[model samples]
Target: MRIAQVCAVVSTLLFTVVAFADVKPNQLFSDHAVLQGGMSVPVWGTADPGEKVVVSFAKQRKVTTADADGKWRVKLGKLTVGGPFVMTITGKNTVTINDVLVGEDWIGSGQSNMAFTVSAKVAAFAGMQDEDKEIAAANYPQLRIFMATTKKTYEPQSEISGEWKIATPENAPAFSAVAYLFGRDLNQALREPVGMVVVAFGASTAESWVSRPVAAGDPQIKTMLDHFDDLYSFYKTHPNATTDQAPSAPQTINARPGKPGPLRDPVQDQHQPTVLYNGMVHPIIPFAMRGVIWYQGESIVGGKAGVAIYPHVMEALVKDWRQEWGEGNFPFYCVQLPPLKNSSNNPMVREGQAHLLSLPDTGMAVTLDVGDPTNVHPKNKEPVGDRLSRIALANVYGKKIEFSGPVLAGMQIEGANIVLHFSHAAGLIGKGGPLQWFQVAGADGRYVSAMAIIRGEAVVVHSDEVVSPVSVRYAWDNYPDGANLINGAGLPAAPFRTDSQDALSAIAKDFTGK
Candidate 1:
């Protein structure tokens, strides 16, 4: 009887061990996935501790042992661009991932703009222009998208939830509109499979997507961390406090407030620094991708301080993401906020965004002409995506195409006028009427409306109000309605200012309440 009882217990223990040892890959490695081509692809998962896991895909095999904590990873060599292949993982259990393709993969992330979908099916996402037609025509099987589930956490998470879906008419409507259009353009141009991994949250601040370490190190944005600490502390002390009783979270400038909830859960607030990165971005690190395309800055916090720190925050984000991904200086492109009225979308924010050009391998899609004065979320996303793809095609794919508009190269004071030189100014012309929105300022630091004329790859500006023009500014307003300086390629010129003294004075005024 004793021997029989011991046998039964041993048998039960063996079954439990085998059941818990079933190998499982990350959600990103499921069926219909697209592996990045021309780079080392990282495949990782969890298995039985000390188990030897072998991953086989497209004539390449990689082997690695699970760590003491049951984590395992293997890097496959560079893959050529082609596949409808199957990947199999063997360990204590066998897992097969089907319909995998090797192609160019890119990350598309930001706030609502990046999260906007192609159809109006979902009420949360404002659908883009030509929704029905765009959705009906979406039948590209080679284009795949993995939309990461929106999540927020106080600490970095090791696992995320999402799935890869091919671009069929049924699925395309739900895909991010900008990402889909960008991928569609790339797929058409390169004649290869393209994948877009979209991780974004609506009405979230840039600081919320930054890593905790990076956010804490920056003095300009460190207050975000302090606020989080205070909120977390309050939650810990008053675990049962209602939303009304809890300390009110600081409102992000021009951001829509989130639904009220229990204060014990700090992750519920998307504005908290690093929460989105912790929950959404951290789990997908080291996934091989060509580059990232970002669209944000409309939800900047801290008022003038927020606008002031935006460029630095974005710079830090780009650098930090590159470092984390182990991809050296990958192309980082962004969209300059378009014109809007009575909102955070202003000249200062756009100027701050332009500072990203100072970084290497970076580009900005100027959207001065694509904005809706009444709505922050413009329905027109076709130009935005096309411009982003234009940058990638020209720089990454070696395509001969105009990727940007006229950029302010330098300014020369010729007589009583300022001549603003520009690159990419081939056949520069005023679209409708004479060049409008130009302002000239003199030593008194006062600006007055000025007339501008296109003069051989440069715009000559002068004002009878200011005889000696020391500085010139073009399209410098929240809603530059008539600003229509475009290059030969018909791309509108980006807004620019020749001097920073006025900007400094504005900042001073903001702080001093003068």
Candidate 2:
């Protein structure tokens, strides 16, 4: 009797150990889980290669085999999203994921500002306020959150470690400020369950977000490559054997009393193609997102490949992301970098962002009037998210909402002055007085703030010093403190240049022409 009892206990212990060691559902199971409404949605996973796999969801059965490399995929036939369903997968072992939800999914990506979390900004505490009850009460049973960890790799990756988490006020503070706000809008507008996969890395350049080989195709990309190579060489030669591994040594040893180090981290400027995509984004490719929103470009501007190559890099990013996502012409909405000090280098990048808008199914949110000259990470994320959502609502989702502020259409040289025409200016009224950000210049090519007046559908700009103006610029300052040219909806028009010039003026000219 004693021997039999001991045998039973040992058998039970062995079963439990095997069960625990078996694959717990790969939380990064699927890049996308479509809201089962009309057609079949694909649900896939990776396991020991050649293992016979079985997937069971809501009485529906699907089977597939692990590929030679241990990657396996299976598609669940079309079903509906009205389920508190459970998903089970079996191969070398069985894995069950509970409280699974099927719903609308959105991909939110970009750089610092877009990645800024509520916990890090001024509005961090505001989320708990009674006024922000909507955000506070955002505990949607079907809403799911997947956050992509920051990564940089030379090649694309197939898996990452993030899972679907239900959204609540408890989970809200850590969410991406911009992405969370955008998702809030979608959740409210659609009145349906929502899923969001947020992939944002702070201070990343546009090139980092795109594939390397593709971005390198542009001759302009060589400058960035050369700059990084030089920095790498410097570090390689000056190897700090003792403290080199520390992140602060490079800055500490190469610094002046009060100024930044002359030699920045050689790695800081290494804007290699797909490095970030491989590490942070590769694990989540082809995520079934309704659209994409971008807020990057600042890092690229300070390097050797600055502003001039901004547009080409943007083009590459759009193309590569779309290709990897396997969706052609996906709606790519971007934020027009906010205004800054006269010394800021991002104005050119902003122009590059504007040029990207001319691409199919693309949109730009102009924030020239909302930037803080001293703060690179602006705190006014509400408007940014709203404007982005407005673009998606109008263009991608086909909602009949007005999407943009006034855009400079053209300038007609009439008499001794020029009349600037703007598009999307349905009710073009200066918020306070006549457009105060207008500037004019003559053949000698000197620009001065010009007197601007609303004349019918156009704004006539003139300067006393110049009787014949050849060029016109509006809100062209790096950071115009008194810029008041906003439409009735409180959206600002992007800065624009009519006649190109040299130096900083030439940079503005590059974007105006593109």
Candidate 3:
């Protein structure tokens, strides 16, 4: 009887030990996943502490020992882009991840537009343009996608929930519209597998993408973050004195009565600085990728002040992401905010997006031609993706193609006229009609509509109201109704200014004395 009892206890303990020792790969590692080629690919997972972990794929097998916390990883060397192989990770137990492919990948990050799906209902579930057609045609098995689940956490998380999904008619309807189209173009152009990891939250601010420590460490961002804490503390300590009104929006909060209102939990708040990064981006660090394609700015483009600080925030984000990846600088391309009705901030945000060009390997896709002033979220996404792919082709795929439209290079104060010289000015052309949105300002710092004519690669501007035009602006307005400037490549020129009147110009002068 004693021997029998001991045997039962030993069996129970053995089962528990085996269960704990079993290895489990992250949700991102699964069948139909694409491993970035031409660089070291990292494969990581959790296993029993001190257990020997081995990863075998294709012709290479890497080994490592799990740490005290049961984490292990192996870096795969450069590989050629063909694979339909299986990856077997073995510890005390084994996990077989099948149908893995080696290829190029891009990370898609941003707000609503990036989160918009090909077949998802429109703003009010009205249905996206060509929803049925696009969903039916999504048959690219070689192209894989993974969208991070929406989550917001005050503390950074080590793991996130999501899975690799193959692009098929059955599953493509819900994939990010911009990301799906972009990946399709890339895979077709490269004639190899392409994968996209879409990690974005609709209506979230850029500050949410930065880690809390990094955001709080910056003096400027800290000022913005401090307001939230102050408001929360004020409310929590004096609940009866909460304000009568909600103050229109989240940032417009007031502790007027000196009490808490509805207890808006900042801990789970999506707008809270670093929450999205903690819940979404941090969990997937070190994933191999060629670059990122972003379509955002609506949340942060609140007004002049927001636009002025946008470039700095963008610069910081790029640098932080690069450092986190541990890979050298990678291309970061963004889609300029298109024309918007009644939204004075769009143009400023567009200028801020253009300002990011100062950073290396950065590019912008101008979408003035495709914009619909009536709708903030434009329905035409094919062109958006094609334009982005052109940038990638020229910059990353060793292809020679015109990837950008004309950009203001210099301004010559020739007499009363301002001759604006442009880069990438191949076959620069304005529309048949009179130039639109060109304004000239004099010493009085006042602007009036100016006459503009395309002269070869330069556009000359002059106004009767201002005899000596010291500055000029083009396509600068909330709804640049008829602004038409493009290169022979058919890409629209980005909105720009040669004047120092805008908020961005003033900040530049004050900050750099330029």
Candidate 4:
């Protein structure tokens, strides 16, 4: 009997050794994957420690050895704009990935809107406009999409769950609507394959997607970490506390009796700083991609403090992502929050989003004219995706096109009037009616409704109430009802304010229903 037991133990040990010896690529390298074109592509995976792994793809072969941790990576030379190639990774065991494509690759991330799918089959996602028609026509074999499962964790993880899928009528319905449209547009315009990896969670904050080390270093964001720490401490001391008794406690308590550490409620508490990054984003670090598109900021918590620090949060996220990816200022485009009724702080949030334009290679897609006042998740995502693609087409792909609407470039104060100069202001006009939603203020800082006119690529504003206007604002309410300003390109102008004053109180009465 003892000899039989010893033999069984030996068999188990051998099986474990053999299992660990097999070379495995990251989930991202599976069949039907799309590699970013025009850049050195990175292919990575794991094997037995010290094992040499050779990767061959698209007429290029690269070799590397797994370190003490059994992790290895190889970078292929810059690829051209076409592929239906195959990749082979050889170590102790050879793995072949077929039907691979090389082309433009982008990462789409943010909160619910970015996660919104092309169809409303899922309970969580609100379907886009003409969902059935769009789904039926979504047959592009050149477009691939990968959606990372939503998750949160206190510590960074090394693996995640997802796979690349070729866009088709069957699969495209589940794809992110904005991302799908963006990829589809690129595939037709650039006439090449396109891939989009979407990683997003509903109601997630920007700070939640930031790395722990990055958030810890920021003074404003560190407070959020501190708050989580306190919540953890409370839960640790009250092991027997019920959910009702401890209202803020994590839903599940997976604590061991004698091993004490920070208790994580990843399921219930997604807003915790760095949680989303640790679980969903960290595992995919350094994945080769052309750029990122983001849509968030509807659920900013912390009241005034949260609203004030949003621009800084976005700055940190953009810089950290670029630094981690080792990609120098790759285009980071974002969607500005659209008009919503009764959302008092939306203008402030939109202002904060615009501040991201100060960073290099960054752009904002204005949605001022494409919002649903009743529904935060508007179904008119075609314009949103088209606008984002316009930015990329113009800025990244060298397409000569008008990618944006009028932006406040300069403001000059003349007696009894404030003249606002704008860039991208060719053929500026108000659709369907006269100019509206323009407001002006005198030295007293009291804003009142003003009349505005388009005058040679500039909007001139004057109010009988303010003879000498000191400030001018356009479409500055939560929902500016008649703000019809647009450029000749038919793109709506982004909301703007010339002064940095707290105008919430001054304009509160004007937007009472909004």
Top-lDDT candidate index: 1
Model 2 lDDT tens row, 1-514 = 6999999999999987665444433445542333433345556666665678888987789888777866766766666656667778887677776665565667777777777775543334223123255456767665666777666654567667665566776776667767777777776776666677778777677766766566556656554544445445666676653233323321211111223444444444325445676677766664455668788766653433356666777887888788877757877878888887744435556666777865677778777766777777777777887888887777656788677776676778887788988666667777777678888889988998888887665788888888888998777767766767655567677777787433223222211122
Q: Per-residue error at 485 for model 4, in Å?
A: 0.7
Expressed as tens digits, the lDDT of each residue in 203-298 for candidate 4 is: 888888899788889877777776666666667777655444433522221111222344445334766778889888888888889999999988
Strongest candidate by TM-score: 1
Q: Sort the candidates on TM-score, descending order.
A: 1, 4, 3, 2
Query: Candidate 3 has what TM-score?
Result: 0.88
**Once model 3 is optimally superposed onto the true structure by TM-score, how far is the C-alpha of residue 338 displaced, in angstroms?**
0.7
Candidate 1 Cα outliers beyond 4 Å, as residue runs: 1-20, 242-264, 501-514
lDDT score for residue 486 of model 4: 92
Model 4 C-alpha lDDT versus the unseen true structure: 0.83
Error of 4 at 86 (Å): 0.4
lDDT of 2: 0.65
Q: Which candidate order results from sorting by lDDT in descending order?
A: 1, 4, 3, 2
For residues 69-186, could you state the per-residue lDDT of candidate 1 as single tens digits? 9899999999999989999999978999999999999999999999998887864547888899998899999999999999999889878899999999899988999899999999
Off by over 4 Å in 2: 1-26, 30-42, 57-60, 76-81, 121-137, 216-218, 222-270, 301-305, 500-514
